[model samples]
Target: MVDADQTFVIVGGGLAGAKAAETLRAEGFSGRVILICDERDHPYERPPLSKGYLLGKEERDSVFVHEPAWYAQNDVELHLGQTVDRIDRTAKTVRFGDDGTLVHYDKLLLATGAEPRRLDIPGTDLAGVHHLRRLAHAERLKGVLGALGRDNGHIVIAGAGWIGLEVAAAARTYGAEVTVIGTRPTPLHSVLGPELGNVFGELHREHGVRFSFGTRLTEIVGQDGMVLAVRTDDGEEHPAHAVLAAIGAAPRTGLAEASGLEIADRAYGGGIVVDERLRTSDPDIHAAGDVASFPFALFGTRIRVDHWANALNSGPAAARAMLGKEVTYDRVPYFFTDQYDLGMEYSGWAPPGSYDEVVIRGDAGKREFIAFWVKEGRVLAGMNVNVWDVTEPIQNLIRSAAPVDLEALADPHVPLESLVA
Candidate 1:
């Protein structure tokens, strides 16, 4: 029943690809759709891998986005465990792995996401050092941590970012002595600013986690093919059993680059430059998710967000563009982190060292607080710790760019909901 002339080839079978395919079908586009994925399984949810799955709170199947039957029912041709080698724009074909399979398409989308960054330092290749990026990685880490048996074993996290901090909390809960070594002066200081970042740092410290702040990990020492200690830039060594390198992620643009797509220079700053509609340098090809650096309306610049909100939203937006109904991707960037019975939610985006003011609502010492970063009286970004419900209102304030009265914003008596309207 689908049109032959309307074939769509989407590369990368993660959230973006899966969601885009579903969105296209939901939009009543009866076209030949082929999804090419490097992984040999159904598209799965990745967020839970760090918390629920890693902690054995959830099953493996619970993390998947779609089941086998759902793909068959929707008429989505899924080519899993296959790698797309390169794209031929002139011939409108994509050459894939081993069998050298080539798929032709009228429209192409590159949702090629990012991979976990590893520590280039020595002993990183040790048997006990792990990076949690996939389900298998989480399962292996859980196995290793469980085998350590709640003793004097230490888990060294190389970064203080969300992933690293989340794992640190998880490691502590699992009865492992967790030591966090962050390059920043404070935990998440780059994103939350020094003020709020210090609050998070204090929270972790109060929970009995050791933090080596403003220290660079130069080398990881190993014993018997396993991590034993991490050497810092300050020339000090910290003892450890397991090492988790969660520094950050790099955009997996190898395929794109091989296909001759213009690679944006991230050194001078800014991510991959896609337009408002998420089109890459080649108009025939498109990209979304962590790999695609698209313009955000709230932030007023091109950003590559490694968050669930952006991954889910950008896919559908790219699908609209493929269908000729272009929509600007201008949503307020939002993210949350759950660690040791505490929930932290962040809304919108603000440049580092750029906020004019930070107004706190609630008690930072109690770890139940809302901090708003105001630039020119407008709420550019904000973070809510133990205040999950504040996310909506604060996000609305960011979207509206509404001026917040300092006194009212700082008052706990004035509901955050009052700011939205």
Candidate 2:
């Protein structure tokens, strides 16, 4: 039933869109495939931007999802530096670029990703103000960090979330003065809750990262269009040669909205609403990655995950589904982070207030431990810090949904596999 005459079009050129193109060909679909990207650069991964690439540990070319030649080799037509601004759902056609080149698609995939939330304060247009969502931004910030390190300059970050903390670690490693500001009592309070989040706060403190918790940025005080310092709502000002707005990101769904697609509200992570098969309200159109809010049967909720793991897996799942294969995307949510000497892998979802108790196994002080969020004795989520080879067992325990012994769960001597029935 593979129609060689039909054309499949994918929007957004990030990891998800790229993987979808690869999957289409792998499924033996002898059809025309077109991939459109707004970014001029080839589709690349975003993690290294705040991790190794920013830290000078990784090369520039290592971030791309595939070699420049892969698209042509796989017969995947790539349209870079262009955008599909309008989609005529009635006609099943998309218009792109200034010329409004129209392309008819038998099935369309929208992998449009999210963008960093802009700082609401004044002086954000200053030269030294930066956000690390795109490669161009990271390339600029990398040099800024090196210059700050050489001159012993200071940087005041506006948020204590993942991007803020990761950038702070890189800044300190580069020998720049660092201070982090957050509205939460502890970092990652929304995701990890206060008990475990305090661990990260203390780790950053030990590494010379100053914290101004329970507050937010008020204004970026600058002179001559260059950031000089930042003022907080608490009436305190910190000298800052540079300022990073690590607030958060919002899903890019203007195209979906313009096309009158069903977009979920902020409560559901604000993305295109997709079914278990990754099909949107319009049956012929699909969504994935940070832009797809789908039904997660295991979590009993329609959730949207804005992380690397979701894009890496959901893209192919959606691709196979688009190819007329039955697909139920119930893969356990997974994500990892590396800051300084601590490397952690987190699986499953346990939003704050959703879990009753958090059990710790191994030595937390040494950063070699696994923390489980449990509700009524059922494992809800697990995060392993400086631990290895435990993701499978952690995910298995969550999937089993069997109540576990609190004492055994907290004991390092017990094997995680034995507890899952």
Highest-lDDT candidate: 2
lDDT of 2 by residue, 1-421 (tens): 3355989999999999999999999989889899999999999999999999999999999999999999998888999999988999999999996688999999999999999999887899998999989999999999999999999999998888889989999999998999999999999888899989989998999999899999999999989889999999999999999999998889999999999999998997899999988999999999999999988777788888989999999999989999999999888999989999999999999999899999999999999999999999999999999999999999999999989999999999999999998
Q: TM-score of each candidate?
A: 0.95, 0.98
Identify the runs in model 1 with alpha carbons over 4 angstroms from their true place.
267-271
Model 1: per-residue Cα lDDT over 1-421, one tens digit each: 7677788999988888899898899988898989888887788778887888888899989988788788879889898889988789999999987688888988898988889887887887888888988777888988877765466588889999888888887777777888999988889877887878887787788777899988989998887887888899999899988888888888888888887886667742324568888888888788888788876666655677878778798888999898889588777888888888788888878767668989998898888988889999998888898976677788888877778788999999998778774
**Candidate 2 CA-lDDT value:** 0.93
In TM-score terms, candidate 1 sits at: 0.95
Pairs that clash in candidate 2? none
Clashes of each: 0, 0
